[model samples]
Target chain A: MSQTDVRMDGSAETRADREATPGSAGGRRERLVTHRERADSYYGRPVLNEPTWKDHDIAAYLFLGGLAGASSTLAAAAELTGRPGLARASKVGALGALGGSLYCLIHDLGRPERFLNMLRVFKVTSPMSVGTWILTGYGPQAGAAAATDMTGLFPGLGRAATVGAGLAGTALATYTAALISDTAVPVWHEAYREMPFLFAGSAAASAGGLGMLAAPLAEAAPARRAALLGTAVECVAASRMERRLGPVGEPLRRSRLLRLGEALSLAGALAGVTVARRSRVAAMAAGAALLAGSACTRFGIFHAGMESANDPKYTVQPQRRRLAKKRAERELA
Target chain B: MKRNVGKVVEYLPFLGIVAVICTTSWLAGRSSLAGRPSLVRTPVRR
Candidate 1:
């Protein structure tokens, strides 16, 4: 990682000046400081690295994983409640989404084969490691459940597998929060407290949307309920994250895509609740809108973090303040 | 009535999944801005 000298205004100072000159800061000191030591480092480029993962591969993967996990749970619920139509649709949906998620995950790796290597170790502190294990269990269980549902064979084994998938699905739906927040990304890491609930709600909304699109309106009542519940939880958690974030929350507020996503999701949920029973067209529209909204939310969050990572001010100032606060507290103690 | 419902069920989720994913990827790709380097001298307001 070569450090290019950048001016306070984001302009490149020179193509080959490795040394900081006195006149560079408009006559400030010319002392050589590591990127960390230059209290004025914010006057330059990014102090932290941007995410290397492709947006489609990783961000889309997050959304799909959530959808699949929730759908698996919905399948289990539908089975237990005697809604064969919903059960069949949700089982198939879960299996398909899980397949999509794996495709994105493997493709996102620099070396596709490294995906297999990810399974070589398990760490309690590592969300990625945990997620790898969860997906391993979830894939087979969801595949079996959907296969049995489709083929009309082995009812007993299908039921057992569906139950197991539900348990694994819960972990799958929520662990992405831990995965991202465990990073140093300001918005994601700072949102550690609310991300799980936000993800859980997003998952529900996605599953509900799929349910609305795939099952009969009468039999899809539970999916509608889940949609409403999930949207409410997601909205509340997101609002709280913004409020708690204060200045750091600027990234969340700045992404237009995020705002559009939230609006579309809420609108879809309202439509689902108010008019889904009255018209199939309305149900389908609401389903599409909600699914689109969930996608927007994930992409919005991804972009906002990249924006934060690109700005040195976002990285340097927060840490500096935190360190100062700790120093003051230590002196007092 | 059940047949109509099945027709919608059979097709839309597959289509919706594909549509949602493509839309997401497009938006993600479009929103990316080149990273800028500059001195940001804002006072920490905590």
Candidate 2:
């Protein structure tokens, strides 16, 4: 993967080969293209050791993860309690997340039009490339399924759509972890087990926020519960990540961004639970906090991944040590 | 597919944006943007 070889102007590179970029940003013959291209060229630069994904990229992931997480939570809660209102909320939430995820996924791409090109060569090796395809596949299927909230409003085909969407939505809720877990980033990859559960919680809280903002206090009780549970999950996930990610996770442990994210998450979690018992307004406030907190978490994680990528120590050392150990064992045998 | 659908869906929300851009470019072209005298354009001999 060199970036310099690819010509952005001559229609999205139809060839399968990876493009080559110069070692330094300015070293290459700067071929200027569209306004967006010029802006994006500058956009990928790093000031920090690890530059987080773009704001839109982070925000889009946050929205989708939250929506997917929250909708599933609502679905689970609604199933238990037999509440159509809650169920309706879940479907709508899932659909919204689906649409937003699609937007984010597409918007985050250098070539939104050629997003499908991601499927050109599916490498189970590359988490980013794989995640792109997963996103492409899951987003629409799940979103369509979630549209059961509206699709069921139609006639004969509505029921079938509902069942199909339910199956898709179910898969969408938890698969978020697959996106991060399969990455080269050590912190995220290592935290794979917890990420799914953690995202599930954040998603629930996000749904709670929307529910609190929209639904009447009585109808939104499950959402409140979902928020509380999600908050707990997020807190636990954060703590576990802190403990597990070790030195490689220093960016997350030290950054001010992580601190803000922690504060917001804590505030949101506490507020959501307390307000659920107290007033509707309090619940709304908590929900907002949880939502913001989740956004921060996504941003923080994105930053950490970039950080992990930049420093060769973080990227190379573990693999080298593992390879050496394997070689020694083979020689001994 | 988003490619085909985006063609139709893409234009809906962005028409105003494209219009603004086109309008601005049209206006700029009509004016003397490239022609505007600058440090580079100033007489090197003088």
Candidate 3:
């Protein structure tokens, strides 16, 4: 693999200069650091500056994750209403999305089972690790819920199984934000508070999409409410992200794709909110917007993260701040 | 409806098997690539 071209803020001192590297913060040269060595060399050079996934690949991830989460949420809702068919459809759909998402996440890792390595040592500091645990919990819970249909022959224990499954399904609904927040990317990290709401909106949008494709109008009726709630949630998520992201959020609001997606989403969400109670067609339009908006969010967030990683300022500045604080402490002592 | 539900459950294991196969093939590909040696160049000579 090739080494990343990461440099510090001082272009004059950094580019093709020994003392410009952050590792040489003291203006003293150290041994040359390899890319692999730099991976764990905190406060040093970065090795991986970008994700390998294409735009479509990233959209697929957002789609599958949202679909899974939404379906799971809908499943819990259906169960509460005593609608077995809706509940069944939700479970089946959620499993499909979950299975697809699991594949994409592993595929995107470029090291596949390296995911297992993540599981070996779960760290609170690692968002990915926490996400892994969430998925692990959700998977079996969903499976058990699906299993309950068959186990209903054992009526005595079936109630317990159903209750347990409902709890798991709820967790499956919205932990994705936790994954995004766990990243070192400023745009996503700063928007952590808004991630759950953003993800919630996207999840509702996904359910709306699937309903458009599969469920009959009467069956999909609740999707209208979901769409409205999701639209409102997405609006809040976007506003919250903007309020919190400051400079980093500029990419989301300013980038052509992001802006277009957001506009369409707003239009779609507004239509869903205003006319969904009136017409099925409007709900469909809103759902489409949700899907588009959700996809845009993933694309925007991923690119922004990559941009944040690429610019020397994002990586170096944070480390420099830490180093400066330490030096000040030592000098004072 | 009951019969159809049974039939769906019956096919689930098959779906799980397919998912397992896909995940395995993907992981195998990943391991082979990560293990392979890709070339890297040295820094400019001072």
Candidate 4:
């Protein structure tokens, strides 16, 4: 391996140059130039620390939280519309997804008490704090609804719990966008305006996928509609976010996982629109694809943010652009 | 009277959750606008 000496001024000297220098230590004379003119940080190091969040744990947490929140809302709607089978399936899915989400969060925190400690204070500026409280509000209602539905007990109370969970569920579905975007991560923070809509749409798509997977074919029309609508919104919001971010969006655009997610979402939407309504097997396949797509999107976004945080150019270029724009405005004034 | 008390006890958890929601919402609204007096506009000079 060739060693390059990184200078404090963000320039690098190749091993060939070092060997050519008089009185330098011995090395092979290979005239390989690797340095290029671009935005760089001190010693070519990252300008910001990448988040320490474990990849699978936090990404799973995001996907499951969205699934749970949207499922709860879907459950409430189904119950109101008198679709018992869909309601029951959605309620149970919400509870299970919530359990998984909480587990992932607690696992990432390293302790259950640490997760609870987040509720010690609620600050409007702190998305994590608000999200913690939102989860606290949402969890029990989802659990009660699911338990009551499964056990056939407390019919009246179950309905109430479903409604309550539905109300909190909307916030749960979208607050995660705020949670991620509130960070200094370039990809996430720069896309803050569209992040919530993207997350909401992903959540809806996943919940619709779950409904179509578990519910009776006759009662799956709403799920089909939701899957299509959510896919459209998610696609539009994601593209808009990328367009608005320009060069800063490079990480997202370059992510293979994001590309796979978009392809899978589009395929699932097409399947749902065409053959899913006519065949149970097709519906199940489409539902699974949609669920996988939503998961991929969450993981893709998380990884893209990590990539942006670790790269000096992603940080430096955006800041320089902003400064340049401000200077131009000042000049015009 | 005993039945009413029992009923209240049964709904206690729900009530607690509601109270927390209300309190947090109020606090969040207040904190978001903390030190932002300009949001409350002064009357225009006639």
Candidate 5:
């Protein structure tokens, strides 16, 4: 009848403990226990706010920027190698993709002047500011190269612009990875190491695909090789990123779009190596697949980052693990 | 009919710019000699 109970081991127990224990004399009062198997936040709210970027706009911007940058580089290489057809096609593709990328970026910002405002200052620490300046410097050169190629005027100026754009393009292709990874999103932040390589490889593959689609077969051998090499690099970087991310990478692992993109990329590379050389239609189809695959990959990554940010557990668990690791290390020391 | 004609005329400049860009892109795609030919015929010596 007493609330306090004594054990044979000389320990005291309470009525509440008796009720909580199974098969106890207190008749085991029915108590509700809500056990949590994993980390969570108050009221099940996310630990981090989801990124406000629109998937259609930002993902397209990412994909088109990469395409434009890599195409300019390929155009420069084609020019140096005397593949005039490939050079013209790549230059045109670079300018077109750059225009689309700028449009998407401006559309996302909701004002054209907001883009110009980004140019008022240069910050080495900010990826967005650096990216704005890079785009500004790269855009005019790309436009000039494409314009001269289109009209057959200012050949000397075109050559200079082509080389300048090519130099800037390498940075443009990979900087978006830093922009996304610098955020607190669990998946994106964790992938900083491999993301740049993945973006660069995807850019190269898409550029090569464009060249193969538009240029003559006789001049497309380099494009085919580039497609194959880029596919290999992208696949390796993606796998390494997922593997290193562990639990934080669940969103990427579970993405059907990412898997489909990988499959399409592999199939495109296979087709490019085999039937693409023999038939123009096959080459075009393969190119289309590669371009679609790259676009899908960018969208998939954007969505996965959003998903990781929306879930409280992804943010909480990683911090908890790191704290535990530091505590253990301190104890050892 | 008059209203439709006025709208078309209003957009003529935009339409013309798009047409020019498209035509230039098509020409660039078709012409192999669109860009300047490579100045170096062979690999440069170190």
Candidate 6:
């Protein structure tokens, strides 16, 4: 007896031959077509390390930091213009958000003590270190402003703090883009030019949302303007980012959930800006939508980067293509 | 003049706080770098 009698079909067909067949065991032809031109990997695994940060904690931190930064700026504007209500609302909002952002950052660090290790060095190459210093400068100022507004003490001190916080807030809002884009992640790195603007717009919208929710309609007019301006900026930056990213932007395009969030955010912002003047409910709804949209934007960007990082083709093909193009250009020259 | 003086007095603590923060950050940076020697590169000789 020969040992070749183990076939269930009572034939001598090999596994590869069976798999390559058109209508064999599991419809193999379609699988072959699906992966026809895809780049190879180590057993189809990612070449780079996936981010170890938790999705909710880090994404929420990004959202809260933006909110705090924008609100601080709004507070400064309101204070300078003598809109006490808006100033108070924005200051309180900024302080609360900064507190939450700090909590989220520490929570994400897993060990709270390790958060101090980040403060041990100030390296220009590390965005996180610079961000920590910015936060250190901004946090106390924001807290003092809010405290003075609450306590009705040291008006001059509060004014100075607001001025300081406003300056730091701008850096805070824009530096987050640096934080994520400085990484080797293809999607984030590629969108470095646009991410800051996108983030700033979202932050402004978030601040506007806070203002409208906290301030009276008359006092919240600035909030409405900020929301509209922020949303417009966000939409423009997002469009440019998608267009310029080439194939690296595929993850962002293919992400239906992120797309849905952005659509909702934009529609909500447009509606809020257009109709909030007449209806307080509309204003409040717009605020809620803007906040949700900002959250979605952050999560979407984070997820897109993760998706790009998970695929080896995204990591390798872009570099290879760029190198080849450069070589060709050099030869022509 | 009195109000100006009072305002200046009030700001003393804030200024002091900022100074302390800067000093602390400077010290932290200094201490970290103190242990690590600078890696200056020398020109390659033929």
> Could you report the DockQ of all the candidates, in the order they appear?
0.02, 0.01, 0.01, 0.01, 0.14, 0.01
- Where is model 3 more than 4 Å wrong at Cα? A1-48, A51-59, A110-112, A144-166, A273-285, A314-333, B1-46
* lDDT by residue (tens digit), candidate 6, A1-333: 233223355554444443434445443323444444455344478878998876666776888899889989998998898667777777877887787778778878888788788888999989999999999889999999888977779999999999889889999888999999999999999899999999999899888876766665666778878888898898789889988998889998887656766776687678766887778678767777877787788878888999999998788778888889999999999
TM-score of chain B of each: 0.52, 0.42, 0.67, 0.66, 0.55, 0.72
Scored by CA lDDT, what does every candidate get? 0.80, 0.58, 0.59, 0.81, 0.83, 0.77
Model 1, docking class: incorrect
Q: Can you write out model 2's per-residue Cα lDDT over A213-255, one digit (the tens) per residue?
A: 4444555677777667777787788778777767666776876
Largest DockQ belongs to which candidate? Answer: 5
DockQ of 5: 0.14
Write the candidate numbers in order of decreasing lDDT: 5, 4, 1, 6, 3, 2
Fnat (0 to 1) per candidate: 0.02, 0.00, 0.00, 0.00, 0.24, 0.00
Candidate 4 lDDT by residue in tens digits, A1-333: 224442234335544543434433334445455885455454578889889997667887888899889888988998999776667777877887887788778878999999878888989899999999999999999999988977779999999999999889999999999999999999999999999999999999888887777776666777788888888999999999988999889989998888888888888878988999989789878887888898889989999999999988888888988999999999999
Location of the lowest summed lDDT over 10 successive residues in candidate 4 chain A: A1-10
Candidate 1: stretches off by over 4 Å: A1-41, B1-17, B20-46
Top candidate when judged by lDDT against the true structure:
5
Clashes of each: 9, 12, 0, 0, 0, 0
Q: How do the predictions measure up, each by TM-score? A: 0.79, 0.63, 0.62, 0.78, 0.81, 0.76
lDDT for predicted candidate 6 compared with the true structure:
0.77
Report RMSD for candidate 5: 11.8
lDDT of 3 by residue, A222-304 (tens): 65567667767776787778766665566566666666656766676666556754565665566566656766766666676
TM-score of chain A of 1: 0.88
Pitting candidate 2 against candidate 4, the one with the higher TM-score is 4
lDDT of 5 by residue, A1-333 (tens): 344442335344444444434434445544565886455453478988788888767887898899889989998999989888888888988898888788779878999999999999999999999999999999999999988977779999999999999889988999999999999999999999999999998998888888777777778888888888888888899999999999899999999888988888888888999999999889878877887777778888998999999988889888988999999999999
